[model samples]
Target: MEKIKRIEPFHLRKDREYEPFLQFILKILKEIDPIFHFENTVVSEDRIDKPYVSLKTIKKIGTTNQGIEIIIEELYEQVAYDIAIERIIVRPYGLNVDLKIEIESTRDTTDQPYLELRLIGDEIVNNYILKLFTQQFQQIPLDNEKLKRELLILNTMIKRRQWYTVETRAKAILDNFPEHPQALLALAIARAAQGDLEKGEFYLSKVLEYQPENCDALYNLGVIYEQRAEYQKAMRLLQKSLVLKPKNHVVLWKLGQVKEAIGEIRDALNAYQEAMKTTPNPESKIFTSTDFRKEAKEAIQRLMK
Candidate 1:
């Protein structure tokens, strides 16, 4: 790729006019005859306001053009349950830019799709390429691999009420898949679990916008309403989720809570008893229970039914 010495807005170098340089990097991406065959590669522009693009590809780039050598290393990182990175390294760049690329940093997860490039070598090519590719992928697509990681985080950490970790992971998931139902729901749970009821409600409302009447969305939103003492709306959403999943003991238990909150003693007792009859284990589904049986049994005892 031929580097342009001058850009139209050359005066704005301090203002992150690096997009002009990335044009050359993009050209190089197309021209280079990669020895490794990249698979599952996809490029997308996620945000309209963002100048960079997100690229995700699976490739084994460990060899050279003329069999010389490349910056090679096998660093394993677990992305999720099924998708594990066996070998993580810079693209096989021999006599090419050797910029330190960070796929995802640990700080704020909400601002993403931007691939970070840290210049390591003193080579001119390295500096040019580093600036060219820096923040190129503001964030990658959530795809399936990222979803799996979010799922595990949701079930294990969020369920345990670890609000900080849950919030970070959910933000990471949303960085790629913005307003994703699962991630949105997880964020809602994290906020609500952390006692930030209003923010929790906001997240669930966003989830409903993407998928209205989504079982998990409906139930969780209902639970939030119940917590806030909005018995009517809570019952409405919880009942809707129940029609879709009648055997959800957790939902039934929540319904009982809503009923009791409004002083419907008999109705609450019946709902609590019904919830007690259902199974207490959470399955692989997204918006299901986390074993509220103990809570339901205690509620039943408190109601003296």
Candidate 2:
């Protein structure tokens, strides 16, 4: 039997062009599963007179190459747009909108041209390869060797700050095993790291659905709510997390920050002091506990004054 070739994982580089990076993602997906095909579904344009115009006139937005050209044309002001083009892969079904890559293009020729690419999906891909694994290994145990290897790859990618690959690989496992809590948590962390807080919150919520007592999910979700300035919700989740994991210095630090945000100075100070005194847990999956303790010390000193 021919061994399946493992593709080297890739992350978005700072110096790379948007179009090329988009093309690279498509190429990687195709390589992962040759059966999977990409089709251009939606092309939104920004006109001088009008705000956002759907390119209804131009037909044949078929292949991936043509889709990319349309985006470039819209960006450079050669086709129609004046301000920017928004939205891509908006189709709901039939074409697997699982990896929706939306490119918000700018028509500016100034330094630091703004081109924001948003990845909107269920947090991962490469479904075909995962499908093969599922077929070959039926009723695999929770601590199965294959699953362990996949999770090990995820952990390595997380340590290397390869968030994009982490999201993709975790997503592949989820495609086959939706109830896998570890993959869900990994995908949540990956999404949040990449600045998709909405997706992050969604996946974390899913994790809690399976394991309500998950300290990591509770604490991370609390942090997300705090970032969004929802102090009450943050407080509730953080408190629950503390009940499960009293020694999590990061959670204590975050709790302090949330309290400080809502003008509860005394509680915040006490929380920070507690965090500084707690031994930093090296097994923290999402945050560096030592950094949290350092921040907690600074916070305590500031609040005392």
CA RMSD of each candidate after superposition: 13.3, 13.6
The digit string of per-residue lDDT tens for model 1 on 1-305 reads: 22322111111121112333333333444434333233322222222221122223233222323111112112222232221111111322343343322221112222221223333443665555545553443334568885886678666775566665566677677766786788888888887875778988999899889888688889888878887788999999999998987888888888998899889999999999998899854673543436777888899898893
Question: RMSD to the native, candidate 1?
Answer: 13.3
**Residue 45 local lDDT, model 1:** 20
Screening candidate 1 with a backbone cut-off below 3 angstroms (N, C-alpha, C), the clashing residue pairs are 112-138, 112-139, 113-137, 113-138, 113-139, 114-137, 114-138, 114-139, 115-137
lDDT of each: 0.58, 0.62
**Model 1, 14: alpha-carbon shift in Å?**
30
TM-score of each: 0.54, 0.54
lDDT of 2 by residue, 51-123 (tens): 3443322222345433432333333234444323322221112234345433332322222223333444443
